[model samples]
Target: MTQPLAELDDVRARLDADLDEVTEPLAASALAEASDLAREYGRDWVDADRCPRLVRGLVARATARFVRNPDGYARSRSGDESVEWAEGAAGDGGVFYTEPEIRLIRSLAGRSDIHSVEVIAWGTRQTDRTGYIPVEDGKPFPYFADESEPW
Candidate 1:
C-alpha cells in the first residue's frame, strides 16, 4: 500500500533538518549510496532509521548531477525531449526530491562557484484526446503568422 502523503511530508521535513547540519566531506558519497536506497525504497515511505540517510542521498545526487555539469544538464533538463514522469516507466518512483531539497543540497555540497542550474518541471504528456478537436469536423483551426510574438 502507498504510504499517506503526510508520512512523505514527515520524511521531507526530516531531510530538510538534516541538510541544514550536513558539512561532512563524506556526506555526499554516503548520500549517493543512500540515493540508491531511496530510489528503490523511498516511494511508499522511508524507514525512520534510514530516512535521514536516504534524504542525504537525494540531496547528494541532485547536487552532484547539477554541480558536475550545470550548463549541459540545464539545457537537456529544459528541453522538451527530456524524459518525463510516466507511470510504469523504467526506474519510476525512484525517490521524490523536491526543488527545495535540491537547492539545499547544492548549498551543502559546496558548489558555490557555479551560480545557477536551470531545470524545467515536467509531468506526463496529456494523453486524453478530449482536448484535441478533430479537424475533420470543420472546426476553425487557429493560426498565428508570427509564432514568436506570444512571448
Candidate 2:
C-alpha cells in the first residue's frame, strides 16, 4: 500500500495530544483517512513524499479535526454556554477536505480554472473559381471592387 501523506505523529502534533491506546489508534485512522482523501482529491496525482508542505498541513489539520469531532457536531451547549462549528468543519462524522483544500489539490494536480483554445477560421470563397479568403482581425476580408460580380 502507498504511504500516508501525514503520519500519526503529524496528527498528534497538530492536536497537541499525548499518545495513548485510544488517541493513537484514532489519530492513526484519521491520518490514513485524510491521506486517502487527499490522494483521491488529487485524482492519484498526489505523491505522499513529493507533495508540498501545504498538502501535508492540510492532511494533518483534517486528521486533527476528525479526531477532535468525529461525530461532526455543528454545535454543542451546556446550560447558558454554547458552541458553533465554523465553515469548513468536518461533516456527518466523516473525514473531509474543505473547499480551499480541494482547490489546492486541484491546482497541484494541474486542474486549472482558466482554459483557452486556438481557432482557425477559413473564410468562404465568393465563388468556387476564386482563391480562398482569409479572416483578418476576427472579421472576414471584404472582396475587392474588381472581384465583385455584376448583379
Candidate 3:
C-alpha cells in the first residue's frame, strides 16, 4: 500500500539526519564496504527501490547541492511518468543524487588527502534487468545527453 505524504517526509528527514554525521574521509577499504552495504540495502526493494535510492544517496552525500535532473528509467516503457525525491524507492525517503555526483563531492572535499572514498552503488549497466516495461512503439528509455553547447 502507498503511504501518505507526511509519512514519506518523515522518513526522508530521518535519512538526512543519519547522513549528516559523516565528516572524516572514509578509507578506500571503508568506502568499498560502504558501497557494498548501499548496494545490499537498495537491492532489498527492487520494484521501486534499488536504483532510485542509489541515485538519491549520491546527492545526499554531496557537498555541492546541485539541482536534480528530473529524468530516469521508469518501471514501464510507455509511461511518461517521472519520480521526484519523495516517492521513489519503497523506503528511500526521497533522495535524487547519482553515484557520479557523490564521487564528485568526495573529490572536491579533498577526501584523498586523508583517506580514499568507499562507494557501493546499488545497480550498474553491466547487468541491469529491472523489468522496464517497454514504452510506446516498443521504445526503450530515451537517450539523455548532458548539457554541452558548441562554443
Q: lDDT per model, in order?
A: 0.39, 0.75, 0.34
Q: In model 1, which runs have C-alpha deviations exceeding 4 angstroms?
A: 1-33, 36-91, 113-151
Task: Pull out the clashing pairs in model 1.
Answer: 31-57
Candidate 2 off by > 4 Å: 43-47, 79-89, 116-151
- TM-score each candidate: 0.21, 0.65, 0.20
For 19-87, candidate 2 gives per-residue lDDT tens digits of 688777888877888888888777563566788777888989998988888878788899878866655
User: In candidate 3, where is summed lDDT lowest over 10 consecutive residues?
Assistant: 62-71
Sort order, lDDT high to low: 2, 1, 3
* Candidate with the greatest lDDT versus the true structure: 2
lDDT of 3 by residue, 26-145 (tens): 222222333343334333222333335433344233211211111222333347764434344312422233555545544533343476687756333343325555676553443124
TM-score of 2: 0.65
CA lDDT for candidate 2:
0.75
Per-residue lDDT tens digits of candidate 1, residues 78-112? 55677444333112333334556645544543434
